[model samples]
Target: MATCQPAPTCAPVATCQPAPTSQAVCPQPCPIPAQFGCGPLPKITNLVCATDFDKAYIPAMYQHNMDIIAVASVGAEMAPSDDITDLAIKIRNERIQQNQKLALFARQAGYGALPVDYNEVAMYRNQLMGVAGMDFSARWATLMVGLLQQSQQSAQLAATRATLPQLRDQGNINARACANEIDALQRWLARNGLPVSATAVPGVCPPGAIAAPYGTGPSAPICQPTCQPTCQPAAQPTCPPGSQPAYPPAPVY
Candidate 1:
């Protein structure tokens, strides 16, 4: 009994397991990770950001971004630095060159003009810039494809409108032929004892006459008044030889 108690009391039982430590269940709010953010560096410099169209199109950079910048900036003294001014001029020149190219392409494609506006192009450019490794070539190719489809639809509509007159003429010819055939059939029916009164003709059917059967039956047949013969005197019987001669009356006007 004494040996068992001594073995049990040895070292107050030190366990091999480490003590429990509390850890945060979820991470605290932090800025977006570097991989998820735009540009190689997590933040963009004002000069580099100014190259972006969205930033350049803001009210602050409106004078730099717009073609009519000089006129608009007059008396409003918020002139950009020389570097920004040069960038704006370059952007404007590049846009003019692209527009000339687009116009040439439109002419070749038989399109009167491109349907998109400069604002749409700028928005598309901004989207491309937001995406890493995206460039203008791919975006413009997609836009041109869409424009071609729209032009084809417009051409089809024009062709349809052009043929509308021919279609109307064909309709009129068919309607006239139908009316002629209806009149001939009505004449034939009238001559074959299916006597149709003048009022019973097409569009002028008599009050109660509405496509009734051709033969006489429960439906009453319309009657026409018959012509009467003119009155004439019958030949007088010969008088007996001995009888007094019948007197002939003298005519007087």
Candidate 2:
């Protein structure tokens, strides 16, 4: 058999390709005015006045006027705790004295001097119990005002409860935005022949892909090496002093 001619040596093929340029993709900007929808408008307070006028006009007017006065007085009485406590104490004492005076007046008028029978005594006792309960309520109302003034805990409690839903919504929105960006980056890295694993983690760039160096450091140098015409030996990843290598060498084909 004839000896085989020596195979001709060919130039080594270039394995390193230039990293693909990343397309400048930006997220669609959020809309202004937020496209927020409002719920139905409330019926105006004047509507109540109009309806009241259509009914027995004089009585309706009187009732509405009294309602306004009562609301105004209650609002004034329930002003900040510092101002309300003294007023509440004075009101409670006056109310108790007035009830006692009314009871005495009724006894003198022969309206409450009934005989001491089980039914009569029971009725009187119930009336006295009701008056006592009202007095206790007034005293408790004053005590509550004092308690509110002594601590700002209630205000803090209300603020904490109000912010909870807003905080939860913000967290959810951030997480979703992060996931979308990461997915896009993974696809980009894979298309450019860079090793990357898909992940759900937000804001994290794909691992193992080379990024342009930010400064003159070795890890991110000012000038990058260009691919040679022929495939050269793969460079070993440089490790910092006292640092371990992150991965094993890629297998040579």
Instruction: Assess the local accuracy of residue 172 in candidate 2 as a C-alpha lDDT between 0 and 100.
Output: 41
TM-score of each candidate structure, all chains considered together: 0.19, 0.16
Candidate 2, 14: how far from true, in Å? Answer: 99
Give candidate 2 misplaced runs (Cα > 4 Å).
1-80, 113-253
Across 1-253, the per-residue lDDT of candidate 1 in tens digits comes to 4453323322222223333443334322222212111111111122122233222112211211222222112202221233223433443453344345435544654545444334533432343343222223223222222222222222222233322343233224323432443344244334444432211111112221232223121112211112233444544444444544434443432
